[model samples]
Target: MSWMPPDLPSAARARLEAARVLVVGLGGLGAHVALLLARSGVGHLVLADADRVEAANLSRQPYFPEHVGRLKAVALGELLQRIRPQMGVTLVPQFVAPDALPRLAAGCTAVVEAVDDAATKAALVEAAVAAGFRVVSASGIGGVGAGLAVRRLGRLVVVGDECTPCAGATPPLAPRVTAAAALQADVVVGWIVGNDSGTED
Candidate 1:
């Protein structure tokens, strides 16, 4: 697996090549976004996922069963390397503490929140805003129909909604989560390429 020349808008390709994108989860949505970014030639990817692959994760998560019990961050990093051997990535396996947000986001041009907890997502949103970084977040992605919604965090734009993951009241649809992840990646890439108008913002 080596670097395949990226086929993207010239400006977007360069921006992607030089950008640092911090992904906050490595579950279903995070897994898809991470894979897309790496394959698309994003220069730096900071992945944080304090969880490991569980049997329940196989259906949606892209990692192999051999990855079961392995830390999501590390496992995903390896998979990314296999996909695009030349991609540069820094995998962090710890949760992002409130106090550490600024330092984590220091040089990042954008942040993508894919954590499963509402409170944590809110905290990440606040942190990204505080750090003046653009953010693309996932919300209501699981328990819903296939859909895409892009929003804004302060003046910066994001790719998802504020709706919490559909709780027990509403059941989650498997296909929706997959679609949502692709939508999240699209919004972020659109922003990096300067095409996002936040029409749904």
Candidate 2:
């Protein structure tokens, strides 16, 4: 696809095309991460989310007005398939528990944690690490800041400001949320490529 940069090394592109990533949560962060990964030619995506799209989600999420009331996993799976019909996508239309994360992530090349709940995020991170799956997670995108910071926690990489929590008074805006999601996507892509080339540190 033209979206895949011509300058990208064939090996990297091949790796991306062969990658199977698990994205937990189809909210603001996961939605964008899924779209970006599909466009970037990631071969397979496993999407999990139990929530249905609501009007409030239209503001910050990658869903259309018609998607309101539709299951996020189903909607996102359809969107990804539309974007890349050749891409393989699995939709788990249910909330994935932290304890179940390891089993879900075991078959994936990497995992992306984008759930709004901090406890769930932590649990998933722990589970992914224990399962030996490289994982990327988001921290704070609920505030006004558009800036993103990346932090490494063991085998997991975290993206977003370390300070702002979604529970804060500041409401989440598209710019900040999307920025964090983009960072998460980039990190996931990098991890896939690095692992494929045996260059991951």
Candidate 3:
């Protein structure tokens, strides 16, 4: 792809093409994260989401009127494949729990924790780490402002305001959500390139 710079060390390019990243959600955040990662040359993607798309998801998520009533993972997988014809995306059309992560992650080198719930996020992080995958996660992606930033804590890089929680009034907005996805993709790409200098928190 044009985006995969020719100057990148051939080894790094190979690593990216061989990398398998598990993105744990297919909503506002996960949608963009998966898209950006695919564009960045991450070859294989495992997308897990049980939820179906609805009209409500059109605002912040990358869904369209035609996508309503379709499975999120399926829809997103279709979109990704359209963007990168050779991109390999494994669609797991169910909510993957911690117990299922190891099997799902198998050869994956990185994990993106883009789920919406706190419980799921915590469990996925623990399991992804135990599975030995470099992880980047999101938290506090609610009601936007200028507070969103990236913080790398050891093996995990978290991006968000780190304050606002997703509520009715404090909903996830597209700009902030896409911004967070960009940061998450950056960290994942860094890991693929062997230059993951996680910022000091």
**Candidate 2, 1-201: lDDT as tens digits:** 455889999999888888899999999999999999998889999999999999999999999999999999999998988899989998899989888887777668889999998888888888888888888988867678456778777678888777655453678888888888888898888887884211233
TM-score of each model, paired residue for residue: 0.87, 0.91, 0.93
Residues 1-201 of candidate 1: C-alpha lDDT, one tens digit per residue? 434364555777788788788888999889899888777678888899899999888877887989999999999999988887777789889988856877887788778788888898888878777777888776666455545676654645555444555446444444666777777777777767677646643
**Each prediction's RMSD to truth:** 2.5, 3.0, 1.8
Candidates in order have lDDT scores of 0.77, 0.86, 0.87
> Which should have the higher TM-score, number 1 or number 2?
2
Q: What is the descending lDDT order? A: 3, 2, 1
Minimum summed lDDT over a 10-residue window in model 1 is located at: 165-174
> Least lDDT summed over 10 consecutive residues: which range in candidate 2?
192-201
TM-score of 1: 0.87
TM-score rank order? 3, 2, 1
Q: Output the TM-score of candidate 2.
A: 0.91
lDDT of 1: 0.77
